[model samples]
Target chain A: MDEKSTINKDSENIERGNNIEVWEDVVNIKDLLLSILICASAAMGGYLIAPDDPQKPLLYGLVGVVIGFLVSSMIIKPKRTLRFEDEEK
Target chain B: MDLSLIMELIAISIFGAVLYTIIGIAPGTDETAVLMPVTLILVLSGLQPISVLAFFISSIVAKKLTDSIPVAIAGIPGGVLSAPMVEHAMVLKNRGLPDVSIRKMASGSVIGTLIAVPLSLFLANLLIPFGETISKYSNEIFFGGAVFLALMTKNRWLALLSIVPFALLIQGLRHLYWGTGAVPEDTTVFTSFFLGITVGPIILKLLELLNKEIRSNLPRRTTNDIVLKQQEKVKGFPNPFKILDKKETGSAAFSSVLGVFTFFMSPAGMTIFLGEVISSRIKDPIKKATRAISSMDGVTNAAYISGILIPLIAIGAPLSPTALGPGMALFNAPPVFTEDHNLHHILSMGDFIVATVIGAVIAISLTYFVTVKYSQQICTFVFKYIPHEALLGVFLALVIMLAYMDAGLINIGGVILIGLVAGVLHRWGVNYGIQFMVLYAAPWIVGNLVF
Candidate 1:
């Protein structure tokens, strides 16, 4: 009975650990996809709107993608900050 | 105004006030989401300009007053602007003083609007001489305003950098629309972009369902019950002035005046700023919280009224963030009213004043009476009977349909894309004010530099 209980506990711990790892991986992927989507959509927007010239659309689209990349990189991720007493209640 | 115009204004005001009051009670229902489409439809249907203005002003006033109902009772904010009121409201709710809080907010709203309209009218008149000159420098002003708003955010540097990219995106889309040889309507492009930005957070959250782990972790409400204390029935014709004390009334009036003058500032930001400024002076915690809530309510109404009125009356441009955002249709509706010839050109000052005053009086009187008398009943019904998720789904559907109708099927895709991108920026602490400024200034930025 004791041996069986110990084995069950070990399995539960492994499952929980796997779940956490999977959650983290999903979050990372979501973040990456968000960035990529923003960049690609911006490029597409430029291409669609670019002046009637065929080559100009492509050039504008590339420029848009570059700007999107720069802006996304500049985004400041939110952080948890400890507050002191002086802050507004 | 003629008798026919006067009658029309009254009819429109009543309709708008009733419709918007109901919409305002439902938490998460945005003023813009409802106002934009409705105003567009009304204008397109050949409603008189004075009547449209009357409808627009009354709807806003009624909505702002009734929005406090959800916040004070259920602790769920009615909209983004009401979010700041929730903390103070929850405090009162936990103490079994929600009725008191509700009365305070409702009263504050009434007094605030009463103070704001005349003051804004006076200010608008004062600024009219410089209207043409101001409009001429709008491009430069927009650029400067964008930078100023960007720097006011938590992620200042990031927001500053974002302006260029956002501007580029808007210009690109505009170009694409024009390139298609479509009848050249700027409103269609802007509407989609605005809708995209407004609904971005919800889109991102929905998209997160792709991951089962994330979905499992999402918070779920177990029950929909909201408890409230019973109050004595008040006699006929409730007076808002009697409910609030001298200090609350004074503070609210002062804040409303401040809000009227600071027309360019974002309403939500102004609410917080005024609330904190008013509350901090009080030493007692309870008094501070209550006063803050009341003053915040005052600021909300005052800011909205002034923000819309000043710009519309003065420059005939959607200059303020509030005007540019929820009130965009008023300034620019195509095939009938365009940016070049808007409501300012169509309606006289006398018409604006009469419509606004009559609309405000009727809307506020009705909303205040209903709120003060039936607070508990309304709260119970909304929380117990209404399915929150179903309401959200309906609103989302409406938004999608509106986006499709305004732009094209392709613009629906554009809306989602913009929503997601803007949603990411929002989650990272970049605010709506900066986004709006960037959107409004994009054309000027591209015209001078990019071209």
Candidate 2:
């Protein structure tokens, strides 16, 4: 089944080009760079925009992390496929 | 404690348990890298000390319980702690009993949590009288720990030789930060450098990816296909005692007790050692593998809990590898939790017990059930929706922001430089344990080097 998927799916991947694997999962390089930029800018933005307080900038930056994670999650479709088999008994 | 505070602790524990349960199943999330950032954020956000303690304990328990299930489902380990059990888990997976691996490992985790919490707290109480002595000599102790851990590594000579030089690099960076007035002289610029070590390998990897020649030669994959073995739905709340056989339960409990005692040593190392010793007498392949995974899971969980608890209760500093890595924020998030005034100084003995009990019980019950009953479903959701790039991006962004917060724009370059050097040393087999101890003892080692 795995071989069949790879052979049959190579045509689509050649065009879609989401073929790179990183940290035990598949990711396109362009998307990864875009996500990093978006997340980092947002985090820095949140930190710079915060009221001058010891904890508030850090809090806002953390909130920005969540927002960036959400945006990236929505825009990027995970490049993984799942199949389930009956337990071998 | 106020009723509201107690209620808040419970709520935070639930949130931590639920969150870590999902994070645990997501393969390849390193324990330190993922855990430290979140806990640091919580500490810096000004949560009450006890609430942060409860959340952290709950997260570790939940993380330990669910991390190994990925090994059963796929050949992949969920985190560094689970990496040792992969070989044993593969034995079961090959024999068509993958779900059995999940049940035993998770049950072992529950048992470990039960044994370690009380044992660790009790041990901490016995050591309280000596806490001051230990605190006074923390620098010497940390330097000693770095040497001890370095000698224990596979590349001992390389590890040993790297320690002093690494200490110099760390101290040199801080001195530069201070001399340039990038940060106030009193501030230590610790959190970002700590984070740099955790993010080091990624920085190296990302740079390599940018090289056209290296990129061309790198392994390419169209997709990451995950195959799952369907598990039977567990009826009612699963009982750990019933899930593990008598012998498995006995070995897991015994190893866990030892794990608590050896909290200062590497948990992964102890897990591999104790698992083999305990399971060596068993002859049957299936039985031996099962025993190994169960016992290994127990040791990993117990060691982690003890590593966090003993230091938090007995000493305010991070004296254990587990404490120094994932639990670093608890001891020294700076401004929020300084070595002199963290959880150890804030919470009473009774408060520690209450927070721990709530955290451990909630995590065991919730994560054990989810891991045993619906591992396949959880794995599916994470694989389908959670992109690895986003996780990496968030971690990278968090490190950058924290670096900026530490000193200013100039310190970002300092962190990247630290990350590059750390990455090279790490690739040379200098483990994180030695590196973290060096980080703790850097100023001392560098200061004492003066003629």
Candidate 3:
């Protein structure tokens, strides 16, 4: 009975450890670039088709999309920090 | 007004509200995005404009109410409008009052909507003529809006600096197409807005993912316990207005007034400002801040819908992004359709009212059920079942598809490159909103100066 209980405890520890390992492995540079590309392309397309005016919504959206991307990638990503503090760091 | 029409209006309101709620609860969907597709379909249906208006009104209201759920339970905001709710909901969560607070908010919103409808419509009747006069100076209004934006943001100098680049980018693109004056026969002018919204973000994220060894890692959040706890906490009857602590009432009233202006400042932007003002006005910092956030969400949603009535009736423009859905639809419809005489014209007015009313009602109505029955379970289910990488992948595909549809594949490719370039600039802490303001306003500014 003691051995059986010990085995169960061992398995649970393994499971928790695996979960943490999996979580740590998830975020990569490739996924980040893909997101940036998706957003920027969206902005460019927006610039192309929005109501015809200067200070174009599309153009501004493009800038926003790009800014959001770069801040996340160059500054936010480099520090390997989580949360908003990474940007400041 | 019409009894038979009233029934139809209610039906549309209910349907619109449900759809809006669905979109609102789900992250990453915008009000404009949902309304745009529906508007397109309604236009094709050849239904009277009034019917379409009903759908618009109902949908907007529903969206406002349901959007708070995700923000309240998880940290995820429903849309741009529901962003303020995140902070408030977090406070409520920490205090073990998330359910009670949200229920009150839902109630307060409904009451606020009830108050806002007649009041705004009355104001709309009075202010529409003024809107007509002001709209004539679109350029001047744009300038004012830009200045307002500069004042509103963190670091005014940075905001001002951001405007120049946005203007250059917008003007350069427009000139590229029209300057050649070789008008491409079939190229649609409105495609750019759709493209910008869809592609710009996707490209930036894609680049980030590619550079890192890490994959997508989103947080796991659930609201089941909070919701169940809320159910157990409320004893007797639920008074929706209980959420509107004494101070919140005045803040809600004040926010209603701010929402009416047609300047290009985002609804979200104004709400944050209004929230700050209300928080300052109250004596209790905690309640003051929470109420301020609540009132900001309520007023922004109401004012955004109700305020547009002025521009739509007076000038042909609908100032709010949500209202733009119907206005753009109106423009795309037959030109012969008389502005006042058409059913669509009448429905547009009705739509504003319906959206306001339904959004408030549904939000209030659902708060209890959401808090008691499904909030925690639903949240838990989502976190447990949904994978972040899969979610990102799907959204990425959607963003790409939307961009491609807005322009062509070539434009899509160009947008990806542009996003990367823009992302680089963003790292330097450049202001995108100012850039956008410049993009549209620069051409006119330069034209005014040069010509």
Candidate 4:
């Protein structure tokens, strides 16, 4: 009976660990997807608004893409966490 | 200034003070929303330049002072500028000392204004000689200010990086509007952008209610009873000096002076920055919190006043974010006070100085009286009768209406899109200051880089 209980506990621990990993992965995916959407939409917006000049549209679009990449990277890798407590103190 | 103009100034100041006090009492009403429309009306109505200046200055002062009431008692910020006071005020509220907190804020505002006026006037006079030179490099100045503001945020690199996307977003919208063969008013377009950003977080939270998972995880109010300290009523007019301790008074004055020099920075940023600086030097948490709250209020008033006064008196342009945002009408009221023919051109330096001082004095006096005597009753009334959802609904409706008025149907869509983007960034701790800087610099960035 003791041996059986130990085996069940080990399996439960593994299941919990797997759940945590899955949750983290989901969060990361959400972040990446949001970033891409923000960037793509911004680029599309620039392209749509640019004048009829062939080169200008492409250049504006490229600038938008660069901007999007920078924003997304920043979102993905935040430099520091903000705390309300810090301001209060 | 003439005698009739002086009388008109005083009358306008009083009217503005009373109107803004009521508006400031209600949470969710932004200074820009109130100031812009009213100033535009006054300007279009053919009010004298001194009268308009007096009205604008007094209204802003009164609003900033009374904004503390909602922040202290109910833990709801009166507006974006007042949001920083929530945490510190909440500390005092939980301790059943909200009365003390309100008193400190009110006193801080009054004292801060008293000290900032003369100093700012002096600085404005000194800076006036360089205004012409500065205007030439306004584009560079805006870019530098944007970069500096981003670097000062909590997540400096993230903020700096986000600026690129934000600026692109703004420029894209501008270009799109222009492409339609429509002459878009810069003020109207920017106003829509401002409203969108201001209401972004609320819109996001409202949308979250549609998701069951998010809704269930959200914190709900568990109680409605707001317990406040019941102090004995003191007779006659309340003195600010008596309410604030010597050390607290000193800090408030010092921070106010410092905030005057940073008029180009966002008022919200200055409040938090000054509060943190002051609080970090103190040892005890409770004492630190109290001092920080007072000085933060001080910074809010001082920064706002100096921001408007300095720019108007020195540069005759909306150089500071405060001037460009809430005080925009004073600089660029179409058909009446265009950018070139603004108050700076019409009013003399003597008129500016006298009107501002008179406006500040009367406005602060009235606000201080109302705030000190009836703050508790006001808080109790708002909390007991005013529904939070109702306030949110009204504000949302107002913003939408304003956006539609600004640029018809297309702006409404633009406002929502901008709101969504800003909402995401704000939730991640990117502040309005950085956003404002980016918006202001967007034209320059696009002109130099893309075109």
lDDT of 2 by residue, A1-89 (tens): 57855753665376355357664456788879988988898889898999997668877887787788889989876666666665324
Q: What is the interface RMSD of each candidate, in Å?
A: 16.9, 2.5, 13.4, 17.6
Residue B408 C-alpha lDDT in model 4: 59
| Deviation (Å) of B221 in candidate 4 | 3.9
Candidate 4: count of backbone clashes, pairs at least 3 residues apart or interchain = 0
lDDT of 2 by residue, B353-414 (tens): 99999999899888898888875566567656777777778878988998998899998998
Order the numbered candidates by DockQ, best leading.
Answer: 2, 3, 1, 4
lDDT of each: 0.71, 0.83, 0.51, 0.74
DockQ-best of 1 and 3: 3
TM-score of chain B of 4: 0.95
| lDDT for position B386 in model 1 | 43
Give the local distance difference test score of model 4.
0.74
Residue A10, model 3, lDDT: 59
Clash totals for all candidate models: 2, 0, 98, 0
DockQ of 1: 0.02
* DockQ, every prediction: 0.02, 0.57, 0.05, 0.02
Error in Å for residue B252 of model 3: 2.6
Q: Per-residue CA lDDT of candidate 4, range B22-107, in tens?
A: 87886667777667777776777788878888898899889988888878866667777877777788788766676778888989
How far is each candidate from the true structure, as Cα RMSD in Å? 11.8, 4.2, 9.5, 13.2
